[model samples]
Target chain A: MTALAEPIGRGGAERASLARRASGWLVLALVLVSLASLFVGATGLSPFAFLKAMLAGDAVDLRTKVVILDIRLPRLALGLLVGASLAVSGVVMQGLFRNPLADPGLVGVSAGAGLGAIVAIVLGGLLPPALAAAMGYALVPIAAFAGSWLSVIVLYALATRGGQTSVATMLLAGIALAALVGAVSGTLIYMADDAQLRTLTFWSMGSLGGATWGKVAAAAPLMLAGLIAAPFLARGLNALALGEPAARHMGVDVQVLKRVAVVTVAAAVGSAVAVSGGIGFLGIVVPHLLRLSIGPDHRYLLINSALLGAIILTLADMVARVVVAPAELPIGIVMAVIGGPFFLWILMRRRGLMMGL
Target chain B: MLTAETLTVRLGAHEILQAVDFTAHAGEVTAIVGPNGSGKTTLLRALTGDVAFTGAARIGALDVARAKPWELASRRGVLAQFTGVAFPFTVAEIVRLGQASGTAGAATDLTEQALARVGLAGFAPRRYHDLSGGEQQRVQLARVLAQVWEPLDESGPRWLVLDEPVASLDIAHQIEVMELARAFARAGGGVVAVMHDLNLTAMFADAVALMARGRVVTQGPVTAVFRDSTLSDAYGCKLRVNVAPPSSTFILPHAALT
Candidate 1:
């Protein structure tokens, strides 16, 4: 008997226990960061000032109140929603493919959503900005959902038959689709006039520049829905990590499972892109960090991923504001800079993980 | 009671299983043995409904191919080859999944008991992938053990199907798993396994189906499949079979007889 298997399993158990313990810490961290969001940047307000302005709405500067109430609050709310959403989707996506490298954008679902949002921006330009925002945001997710569904459909159509989905083939299809759609997005940029190009460019790189209460309102439910639904998937995913035939012999309905996993991932990731332009790294980072911390038990792994994603993004976006002072860095840029390196580390170290390791 | 009748599995244009007929009543172990690509796994998969095939497999009164998956799952528990190694699942959790084949409360308690039967009682928290190949096989057997170990329901008897369950196991675990399967049959459940080891098959299997190139060359008691003529015919080589003096049959390859 290899001592490694038991110890490793025990190690996973140990980490799961640790994750369960740190879970409270992460929740506290999010709460503290939520409070910190109110206090961060240019306000020069003491925590008391921040709290006073929030409770009484009688700050000396109305702009400070506006900054806290209108701007920061919505941003915090959207950041939390988008972060948790991406992270949950990432957990589901990586678990489904058993590939740690999989991310909404890396696999092109977000790019597809990006393309949808672009189309809405360009096509909806005929309407007013508010209407265009409504149409573009609405259509972004619908388009992203449609696009993601299409990519999944194509992947399934090409690689799956006889009730089997080939992970390798689906991944290759995602890579190929990402390149093709990315090229289309680039072409959309080239075709746009300078004015249109600016929004398109920002959306392309990803941003949380438009976190209205309305957008947050829209994203929160779907994000919450995904978060709530994720833990139930843990057992099925655990069975699946065993592989198609083994799972089947063990009496899992493999085809039904794949369908549920893909659709749920689409719903979670799609709604996220609707609110936040194309936040990168959150999805990939959340699940990988959780997996590293908690092992592959989807039961614990999924919930931990959600918590970590929420915490990391909330903190990241807060830092993005303070890093540059009054001129805020688009959070998409911040996440990419931080998340890109980690992505490389995962990719580089992944040969040891050929079987979705 | 479990039986497969006229089961034909077609792979593209080639027939992988050509009208294979087999049966195992509760209280017996049957080994489906053959060389690589000899339809051993194909037959087993077909019986488990892991593949679509043109034939009928019945567990008691329910036609296995047509039974609702949940219905069939309760009646027949299967453990295929130990190929997939997913990290992070403790030995207990994997076995717990097998308990899903039983009543809710019984599932948990039986899973614990099944692990102990395979000499892995204390290994509940061990990572499944971290185990050596043989130990992993034992754990998987523990899972199937949990599955079929369900006390009989009023509806149907439980069936155990394993495809190359011991292929990756070492000598000790091999005997452990085989004995476990044998005990399942003795306990009034049916166990049908596809095995590569003729010696082990001879030792424990109540009957054997010797297959070659998708056809059953001979199907009978263990004594019939172990004969010199059938052995030579199945392997396409000159072979010798001799009974050892230890009060049981022992087969040696011609190359090892020195």
Candidate 2:
């Protein structure tokens, strides 16, 4: 036990406290950004006016009430759900692959879901009239979910041999799968008429403009379920960082972890993409930023990523609303414009550190 | 104690390990030494359940193949030869992963103590990827130490299975790591390490198992296995065992005349 004497005196207490403080800060940012998003739309509803109306209580006008409650609230809710879902799924996928660059979009889940949505839109005529009419608006999201799960299952199978999963193989296979799916989606778009083509294009660009209480209700449960189940994965993912053999030696069920991570990413990203279309970068950006800031302890990174993901996406949605004003820019474009440069910066900084690509 | 009987491993068309019968007892350091591709690593992997194998390998009474990972984890810790972590985890965080299947209690203190034991007390917050190769290897050693901190558990003795634990270390650090393994064995734990340094192996190992061409050529007390002829035949080279001052053993490979 004498060997256990403290050799160096530096405190290990700082990281936990730093993580706690960062979590508090992220939550505060989420709240502030959500409030700003509620008032920053093209409707000319100023934050001051909104605050005054809130303070007045029951004195607010019908137009203000409708804009705040019926429109902005649902959009904010959907944005929060999609943001949290995408970011947490990113953490899971990255940890599972043991690579910072691994993302749901890069791994073909978003593309698969996009293809599924396109199929529903373009090929809906092929379904029985009664069934198509009955499914109606719900068909695309359901199809998208199924497609995402299918792609991930295939990707997981292809990338894994025996009990080991190769991150490089997963990434390369994902790119190939995405290209294959994209080509098929393109063919579907070619067969579509102008209106269907417009829908497909708009969905691919990714917008929160179509947010409604119905969409919010549909996507919320799945996202919440995934988020709630995510923290339980922290310990397993942490062990996995040591490589699979060591992780298994440390008592982590590596197979179970892989299955759970794949399912969680598929469910969460699948639902988000179903509702919000192809919102890119939120997954990769938020987790990488949080890891850089707080270190890669998944116990802290996952929770903080969820909060910061919500805040950043909400703020980005706000920018999409006001930057052009009246006519909305797709939130996906806003995120890419912001996240692309940030990703490049990360790569440049870690060029020497990134081994095995 | 760890025991393997008639263990055979085949990867596709080639046999990696053949009928490898070995045993490492509690309170002893067992060193497995062989030439490159001599199946020393493969044998270690088979013993730790890292690779599928035929025949029997057991940690205490639990079968290596059938035992649950968590069940095995509480009894033994393993240090692999190459641990390539992909993220920028701190030293403390990497070590804390060892506690994943440990009994829930005060782990932070244990983590710090483990680091301190490896001469890395204040390194908790240092980025693991940022550390030098030798430092990173020690951090991994600290992690394994933390997993089975108590050499003797309620269920008899624990074990440390390491694959070339000092391969990346300097001479000073190599001795330090070897001393750590010796200390673990002295404290009633079992140590099974794949070693290449014959001098260090002779200095620390109570028992030596020599493998050549996927088979155990000789295994027993150091005196019996360190004979020059046995070493020469196992390594397929003319080797001289030099008895240094104070009975330390060193193996020297003879070079051909120019």
Winning candidate number (lDDT): 2
Query: Could you tell me the lDDT of residue B7 within candidate 2?
Result: 96
Q: Provide the lowest-lDDT 10-residue window in model 1 chain A.
A: A1-10
Clashes of 2: 0
Chain A TM-scores for all candidates read 0.82, 0.88
The digit string of per-residue lDDT tens for model 2 on A1-357 reads 111121222233556666678888788778888888887879877878777877887478889888999999999999998999999999998898887877877567888898899999999889999999998888888888878988988888999997777767878999999989989988998899999998888888888887889889988888898898899999889888878898899898888888788778888899999988888888887887666556677888899989988887888899999989888998889998987887788767666644432
Model 1: per-residue lDDT, tens digit, A289-348? Answer: 556445667877787677778777887787787888877787888887877886677556
Give model 2's DockQ, 2 decimals.
0.50
- Looking at candidate 1 chain B, the ten consecutive residues that score lowest on lDDT are B100-109
- In candidate 2, the residue pairs with backbone N, CA or C atoms under 3 Å apart (3 or more residues apart, or in different chains) clash, namely none
lDDT of each: 0.73, 0.85
Candidate 2 CA-lDDT value: 0.85
Q: After superposition, how far is residue A340 of candidate 1 from its true place, in Å?
A: 5.6
Model 1 whole-model lDDT (C-alpha atoms): 0.73
Could you tell me the interface RMSD of model 2? 3.7
Candidate 2 stretches with Cα past 4 Å from truth are A1-12, A46-61, A160-169, A341-357, B104-108, B244-246, B255-258
Q: What is the TM-score of each candidate against the true structure?
A: 0.87, 0.92
